[model samples]
Target chain A: MEKLCRYETDRVGYVMVLPYIIFFLIFVGYPLFFSFILVFHKWNIISPMKFAGLYNFNFLLHDPLFWKSLRNTLIFLIIHIPLQIIVALVIANILNQKIIARGFFRASFFLPVVISGVVITILWQQFYSFETGLFNTILSRIGMTKIPWLINTKFAMPSIAIMATWKNVGLYIVLFLAGLQAIPSSIYEAADVDGATARQKFFYITIPMLNPTMIMVLILSTLGGFSLFIEPYVMTGGGPINSTLSCVLYIYKQAFYFNHMGYAATLAFTVAFIIMIVVIIQRKLFETEVYA
Target chain B: MKRIIFYILLLIATLIFVYPFIWMTTASLRPEREISYLSPLSRNFSFGSYITVFKRIPIVRAFLNSLIVSSSITISVLIFSSMIGYALSRLKFKGRELIFMVILFTMMIPFQITLIPLYVLMVKLGWTDTYQALIVPGMISAFGILLFRQYFKAFPKSIIDAARVDGCSDFGILYRIIWPNSIPALVTVGIITFMNTWNNVLWPLVVIRKTSFMTMPQMVVLFTVGGQAEAQVGVQLASAMMLAIPIVIIYMIFQRHFIASMAHTGIKG
Candidate 1:
């Protein structure tokens, strides 16, 4: 009777979790396995599958557009991650002070974070417009020349980077604020007693204490940087000479637009692999600094 | 002097962060000729652009579709995740540890890696342009399950034991005894899941080809990019506002819970 009761409860437990497990299998598990298999075969929606062995990988290796997309993504990270950290840190430091209407200020900053990416992208696209954009209007009023923000290739990626920074900096500010608050006041007090200047205290105490949050921000920013799609898609369509084509967007176009299923899957796997490697390296670099 | 400078800087930062949205709303109310003006106080404040937006796209239908998809996904995630969470945390079941590990492993895999094959799978199932395509794949989140499992693990075991002694089944104990106490967790998961599903663009962009079935974000993107609303900057901004206003209102009311939940989940934006 004891064994039977135990089995009955076990069955109930399995039954309780059964729905999710099945959903996971159908949605996550099957796709994961199929993506791997897809890397070795060519099959558009209408066509039959043909085993294509290492051709997709070889083609990707030789594809200049793939390299360009990878390079563009790196350029985005190079600009965006540092800009995000600096801007977020400065804003967080300011907001951390005992200021009037601090809650109101924080909410105002975070308002953009809650808005959808597509909305932000569209809003900024108009602001970046050459003819009658807000930025150019302001520029011309100040006796400056009107520069095409999105239409110009040299300025397109950085313009997008600036908008992205504005859109996401608030989340990092919140993170940094939490980290700043968590640092005990006694440390600052001791530094004061030692006659440490504000700049000295910031460098020696504040920066060091913020190391962990900085690392987390770095990793998340890097991952987000890799996933750049909707911004360029809405703003530029990866154009003005394809200067803004990101890896994910390229994979998307290849699969849906160009109907190269095998190649797109291969590119997706490569990007995922690259993300893992980059995240591991980032952790090692920052984690060592934290420990030191 | 320093305090004065700080206040000045704060005001400027606030304006910089907030001015575009103010501009977007005002521009949407302006005529085409006046839409380019930076000032929010415009003489051409009218609903003409909004009317044009409504005529160009099925905004109401798209909004309803988004509502249905997000609500369905959120409800299912709450029910199924809580069930699995309770099972993992409270039950003495075989293979529980292994299952938990699998769920955690799934959380680490980026959705981009699974995009292609999942699209193919949906096509094979003939689910394209259907709500099932948009809603089914996201019915349960691994992160939601983990979050609830952590919450449920901390609940007192004595109460659950007493309920069992009173001839309560496990399901009854969960539905009756546990869920009421887990309201905070439910709200956190519910808000996060709802916002994500509501704002999700890429998946719906891939699956739903027809305009009638598009979610708010997807419709807004399509309409603004190259659709009939493209040339009309006022109409485009109006469409963008339509997507943003509802979320902004929700955030205003639930700002505290939203921030707390974000902090708990460690999700950025």
Candidate 2:
């Protein structure tokens, strides 16, 4: 009788999951398989696909623009990851205190996170304008020569990095704040009794305790860094000599603009592979920290 | 003295984060030539830019399209994910753990990898430029499934058992009992899904070629970047503000829940 009842429940479970399973198979499973097959074929949407084994990957390997985009993305990660950590950590530490109107501060900080990326990019485009932009205007008023923020290639990627950091630092702050709250008050009290200064307490107790959240922020931001698209797409159109062209934007242009579907698929897979490897390394590091 | 210094620093940081938004709003209201005046309190406030934005784009239609797409996605995710969550948590099923693992694994694969194939699939299905292309692929989210599953697992099983014992069917037990008690999870998933879908630009950009079918972000990006409104800075700012204000207002009303929901998801926007 128990066996029969178990069978009946199993049947019901499958029925309940049927819709989700079908949708997932159609949307996710099929596309995943198709994306892989696309890497082996050469076809624009206009013509029938012809098998071109390894040609797309071969082109990707030698493409200067491809290399440039990868380099640009790495530059983005280098600038973004550290800036995100320091700013988020400092602000989070501040908000963790008994500051006045803490809720208002938190909300204001996170305001941009809720806005559309396209909107934020456009707003910043105006700010990064060469002559009449707010930043340039402020510089001139302060007796400093105005600098071209977006037009000049030297400052373009860094300018984007700064805007992205401003847009997203609030999220890491919240994450860090949560991590900070999770640390027991007794630990801080013990540090106080030991006559530890504020700096010592932060480096010794707070940073050590918040290791897991820090790792999580690192992984998420690294993944986000790889998926950099909208900022460059809206801000510069990956231009001023493609200094700000991101890996994903490169893939987007290949497929949509240039109609090299196979090559685009190859680039997309390369990005996914790189992200997976990075995330795996980060996770391994996290595990080692936990074990150590 | 230290506390005063801290407060001053905090005030400066807050202004750095918030001043651009205030500037954007005020600039939108200013005359085109005075848009970059640096003072947010320009004397030449006008509705001219807004009028231009409305005239250029089918702003209302795009807004409605975004509404339809986002709400449809949110509602479907809520129902289907809850159902899957309930089944995975409550029911005795074969390959349950394997199925759950599959769902979790799918979340790791970035959407870019699937973009080309999915676009091709949409084209083959005659879905490009239609609402179906925008709506169908995103109807069920892996993240939503995981969230609901975690929430439902913590819920007391006794209520579901009682409903089952009282001759309720599986669907009935879920709707009548589990759902009523799962408001927090529903709201969290709903808000996150809604915001993501509403703010989604890249996929919609690929699929929706026509301006009439475009979502707000897609429309705004095209308008500015395509040089349609590039000459008029005020109009561009006004279009961006139009795209941003709704979500910002929603965030203000549900600020606490929004923060909680994002923190819970562990994914930063």
Candidate 3:
């Protein structure tokens, strides 16, 4: 509270922040450090750990369930990334237009995000019910038989994918809308004066202008797709098969269900490592491709 | 012809996007057995199933639990982080860059990485199954402080200096000079943190063992999966609707602020 050096203010600030800093160290830093140690030894936290060396990592690499979960995560990403981008871009573009009631349209577009994920997931679970779901009701009216959504392995991952995208795309929509608004209107007007068609203006002017936002959206969505936990956790419980078993769900099941803390830690580390590599690659890709 | 067709297609796309949510709402209102009847879009609805869900489950209590957890976390993070944010931005200090960098790095580490350790900490603290477990651990969010520092740095420094000259204490200057200028940033952090805490599932699932202690999302998960051997689809939808209605109402009130907040926060982070 008293003056010394600017350094003293830093000291005072650190003291002010001591509580949070300590909490982060104990909670966040401790877990992160121990998780690595966890990957090395086989323990359920109740039992004495047996040093497993690289066995956990080896087991994770060879484990069929882990591979399946990783594959499922990739499939979720493949579907989610494109769909989130396209839907957000289109909806943001429309909302950005000088059309009527922009606020209303934007609010409607973002409605899903404000709602709870558990609510959204359950809503979709009901929507996915084979016997009495909203999907089936609508399909039946469209002259189709009931589709086994969650139960059928073929449809489960995609079903989860669609629901996840719906619940999350609003966040991306807002991001893109901000980017859209930040683009100088003069660019669009310049294109118009140059006799650019509407589609050309969109392709030439809008797409190029939104590059940074697109990259951010891509990385965020990729992180999201990999961290896929709750939807599949609640809806299908990771499946009729392992069709929708995301890596996080697999780790959760291993740790909580099977009491394989060591194995689950390995799985989490593996996924986190993969996510880091993906982020790095995305940064590289965006850096080179943009402003070229 | 082509333009009309394009407009028609956009309308249809919008319907496809929205129709399931609309149907979910209707089915949630229908009698349980009537949920299977195929006229969700057209059918007249009743509030009976919603009443049934409320009658059958701990929906009201969970709603209150969620409100408390979300609001407490939001308010605490707003207040404390602003204090820290002001000091970090305005006050010169040693190791400031290191501290700032630590906050940035913490953002990059997904919260899941800390979940197990934090859980162990909670159990050891004997704070498990209590609101303290949820609220205290997250009170000084690095993300909020970082965002607020970015905001506060842009405020007029002369005003804070003037307040300091006029015999105001450091905290008083922060409260009187910079705090007013930073309301937008506070709202931004508040909405994001509130929504985040409200939707938090994995940590709460690990920490909270009792159904009586459940948040709305927790209860929604329970009501969906952990009922009598037979689950009623309509009731589950009803539970979701009840959990979501308050959020949607709030979103309607502050839609612009919500959008702006999320946008600036995301872009900054």
- Strongest candidate by TM-score: 2
Task: Compose the digit string of candidate 2's lDDT tens values, residues B1-269.
Answer: 98889789899999999999999999999998888888888777999999999988898899999999999998998888888988888888888888899898898898778988899999999999999999988888888888888888888878777776677888898888888988989889998999999999999989999888999899988999887896678899999999998898899888999998997777655
C-alpha DockQ for predicted model 3: 0.51
Tell me which of candidates 2 and 3 scores higher on lDDT: 2
lDDT of 3 by residue, A87-128 (tens): 999988877767655666666667777777887787777678
The positional error of residue A132 in candidate 1, measured at the CA in angstroms, is 0.9
After superposing candidate 1 on the true structure, give the runs of residues whose Cα lies further than 4 Å from its correct spot: A1-11, A289-292
Model 1 residue pairs with clashes: none
What does candidate 2's lDDT look like per residue over A135-235, in tens digits?
88889999999888889887889899889899888888999999999998998898899999999999988888889888988888888888899999988
Question: Interface RMSD for every prediction, one decimal?
Answer: 1.8, 1.3, 2.9
**How should the candidates be ordered by TM-score, best one leading?**
2, 1, 3
Q: Tell me the tens digit of each residue's lDDT in model 1 across A1-292.
A: 7544864456678998899889989999999999999999887768898999998889889999989888888888889999999999999999998888888888888888888999999899889999988899999999999988989878888888888889988888888899899899999999899999999999998999999889888988888878889999999999889889988899899999989988899999899889889988988877745432
TM-score for candidate 3, residues paired by index? 0.92
Interface RMSD for candidate 2 relative to the native interface: 1.3
Using Cα atoms, each model's DockQ against the true complex is 0.69, 0.78, 0.51
RMSD of 2: 1.6
Q: List TM-scores of chain B, every candidate.
A: 0.97, 0.98, 0.92
- Summarize candidate 1's per-residue lDDT along B1-269 as a digit string, tens digits: 97899799889999999988988988899999998887788766899999998888899999999999999999999999999999998887888999999999898887779999999999999999999999999998888899999999999989987887787888998889999999999999998998888888999989999988999999989888876885788888999999999899999999877776775676754
Please say which candidate is ahead in TM-score: 1 or 2: 2
